[model samples]
Target: MEHRYLGNSGLKISEITYGNWLTHGSQVENDTASKCVHAALDAGISTFDTADVYANTVAEQVLGDALKGQRRESLEIFTKVYFPTGPKGHNDTGLSRKHMMESIDGSLRRLGTDYVDLYQAHRYDYETPLEETMQAFADIVRAGKALYIGVSEWNADQLRAAHHLAKDLGIQLVSNQPQYNMLWRVIEERVVPTSKELGISQIVWSPIAQGALTGKYKPGQPVPAGSRATDEDGGGAESIRSRYLHDDKLTAVANLEPIAAELGITMAQLAIAWVLANDNVATALVGASRPEQIASNAEAAGVTLDTGVLSRIDDVLGDLPETDPNKTQSPATRLT
Candidate 1:
């Protein structure tokens, strides 16, 4: 896999990263998770992104278990804070110093790592003061528990503010994990521009829109058996089989069949290549339940999309959706 510098931070990351959101504990079995991890590593994917909230922390444990015997120093491991891992108690979540301190310890324990390459805040916590959050992150970096700090799902303004706060305090805010894909163009406006200006790289999650772009589900047909769409509450919060995920404007799976055949690439490869077209994106984190999924995704890092193909894709994505389906927060109202 191709590698890129994660913002101005000295860390280099694989262009295609593996994520353990719906894959490790929620969907895939232990052996399957091992295959997925092996596929990623064999494909030169060194970055593995997980979070404390994913599968209630089972994701991290599974990932750690998968990476156990291999060389640890070569991989870039990332995990996030925020999101309640415990009950509804205030200490269970948010970016406060106490919560962050406790949370990182728990994360380290679960991931079987003493320190993380990058530690991110899962979301902007209005409940915590900015100082408290930034200082907590800074302290982690100072203590060598975290090499770089990042924010996930935070808007452009919040990201820039965090970057400035880190700069002022001598902490390096390296990357911002956002949901960016062909179907989710929300970051094309504010967040991308702001992150580019501040030299913060965008590590996009759900580059394939939770496998929707993979041509797995046929519209007007029964949901693919055992697919994420089968989840009662939706496999993921944003993946509730919406109109955007349908086979409507984006020319569905059938539309891309010819293109995939021509390029000898899958529809998922096209979607991932499109997301990585932006230089600001340090990595596109894709989830995988099966080893083939990881192998297929990692191949996308090498696929090239010419102007004609990109325009055809643009036409397919015409006008674009104002609302980002993958994101919990709307970019327009996120800062407001």
Candidate 2:
């Protein structure tokens, strides 16, 4: 797998990071999850991303158990804080000093590591003071709990404030994780340029638009039996249905099949390579429910799409992508 530096920091993560967002503890059995993790390692992916909110902290334990024997220094494990975990108590959410301070320790213990490579704020906490949040992150870094700091789904202004605060506190605010794919370009307008100015790179998730870009969901056909569109229990069925499941978008996405065929790669690989073409994108996070899925997705790591193929992709999906910069936002209030 190819590796790229996260933001301006010295930390280099696999260009295709294996993430267990919905699959590890919620959507798949533990044994299957471990097999997928092993497949990622075998495919040369060293970075893993998870969140405490995923399956209420069960995902971290599953990932930890899967990666039990690897040399610690060879991995870059990332986890996030924000949203409720553990009984959904009032104090169980947000980025307050109490929550962040306690969350890091819990995360480390669950991941079976003394320190994480990157600790991220899963969302901007509208309820907590930014200073308090950054201070808590600074304390986590100084206490040797996490080496660097990051945030997910934060907007440009939010990133600038936290970046300045992190600088003042002598900590590196390195990356902002966002949903970026051929169909979801919300971060491109303001977030990307602002992050570039602040020296923060993007660790993008959902590069395939929840498998819509994989060309598996046909335009007028019934929903695939085992695809995410049919997984309403613990998967992303709702979002996939509401966003990209319509016939028009599916037809547009289908137009790219010939492009993928010409390149001798799957549509998923084409989707992933599209995101990596951006210089500001440090990594594209991919997840899988099966071991072979992980191995197949890893092949997108080094694939490159030139300007013509990129233009063809845009022409195929023109005006279907979400580009509203205001769409990138956290909850107006805490979910608890």
Candidate 3:
């Protein structure tokens, strides 16, 4: 896979990062997850993204086992904090210093690693002071637990404040992870500009809009069996339905079939390539329960989309994409 520098940092990561969010320890068996991770490595993917809260921390354990034999220096491992993982308690979650300290130790123990390449805040902690959160991150870096820091789904204002604090604390905050796809452009308006100005690149997740852009969920058809839309666990179906399962969105996605055929790529590849077309996007994150899925999606890396193809995508998905700057919101209370 092609690699790029994450923001202005010297660290280089694969353009296509394999992520285990809902699949590793929840949707798929451990053996299946291992196969998928192997497939990613075979495809030359050197970056892996996971979170401590994913599958109640089972995902990290499964990923660590899957990556056990590889040369750790050759791979970039990323995980996040700011979510409840252990038994519910006042200090069990959020980005407070106590929670971050406890969480990083637990994450390292579960991931079987002494240090992670990047540690991110899963969300902006409205309850914790920004200074406390950034200072804790600085301490994590100073302690050699994580090399760099990042934030996920943070608004432009939140990012600016954190970036300033990170600079003041001598922390290298190099990336921001956001939900960016052909169907979701919420990051394009303000977050992208602010992050770019702050020397931070974006590691975007859900480039396929949870498989809606793949045209697998046909408009007006029954939800496909075995698809995330049909998954009963983890509110998967409900989440997709609320955002991308609408008839209008599905129909718009279907209209891109000929475009994908003309380009000799799958709809999924087309969607991923579209996200990578942005210069500020350092990587596009993809999650899979099966090995073949990673093999196919990895091809999107280094595959450049021409201007006409991009225009066609915009024409088809016109006005359906959410670009509201105000949509980048954090929960008032920490998520359980």
Candidate 4:
């Protein structure tokens, strides 16, 4: 797998990061999750991204157990704070000092690690003051619990404010994780430019639009059995159904199949490569339920799509992509 520096920071991560979001401890069995983790490691993916909120903290335990024997220094493990975890108490969520301080300890205990390579704010905490949040992160860094800091789905203005605060607090705010793909270009207009100026890189999630860009979900056909669209409980079925399940989007996605065929790669690879074409994107986060799925998606690490190919892809997708920068936002209020 190809490796790139996460931001202006010296830390480097795999271009294709293995993320266990909707799979481990929720959608897939533990044995299957472990096998997928092993597949990622075998494919040279050393970066694993998970959140404490995923499966109500079971995902971290599953990932830690899966990665038990390898050299710790050889891997970069990441977890997030915010979102209610552990009994969902009043103080169990958000980026307050108490919640962050307690959440880091819980995350470490579950991940079976003393320190994480990166600790990210899963979303902007509207309830907590930004100063309290940054101070908590600075403390975490000083305590050696996390080496770098990041955020997910934060808008351009929010990123600028946080970057400044993190700088003043003497912490490295290095990355922003957002939903980025061929069909979702919300980060391109404002977030990318602002992040590039701030020296923060993007570790994008759902690079295939939750498998819609993989050409597996046909335009007018029933979603294949067991696919993300068919899964209702823990499989992000609502997200896929509400976002890109329409025939207009599916038909546009299908038009890109020939581009993948021409490149001798799968539609998934084409989608991933398109995300990586942006210089500000350091890595594309991918999740898998099966071992071979990880192996196949990892092949997109070093693939390059030239300007012509990218343009053709744009032509095929043609305005179906969401490019409005305003769409990149966090919740107006913390979820209970």
lDDT of residue 220 for candidate 3: 90
Q: In model 4, which regions exceed 4 Å deviation?
A: none
The lDDT per prediction is 0.82, 0.95, 0.93, 0.95
**Candidate 4's C-alpha lDDT?**
0.95
lDDT, candidate 4, 161-249, per-residue tens = 99999999999999999999988899998999999999999999999999999889998899999888988887889989889999999
Q: Candidate 1 residues 154-221, lDDT tens each?
A: 88878878888999999889888888777777877788888888989999987877777777767677
Candidate 1 at 110: error in angstroms?
Answer: 1.3
- Please write out the lDDT profile of model 3 over residues 42-111, one tens digit for every residue: 9999999999999999999999999999999999999999988878677888999999999899889889
Provide the TM-score for each candidate, comma-separated.
0.93, 0.99, 0.98, 0.99
Model 2: weakest 10-residue lDDT segment is 227-236
RMSD of each: 3.0, 0.7, 0.9, 0.7
- After superposition, the stretches of candidate 3 with alpha carbons farther than 4 Å from their true spots are none
Q: Which window of ten consecutive residues has the lowest lDDT sum in model 1?
A: 327-336
Clashes, model 1: 0
TM-score of 3: 0.98
Sort by lDDT, top down from the best: 2, 4, 3, 1
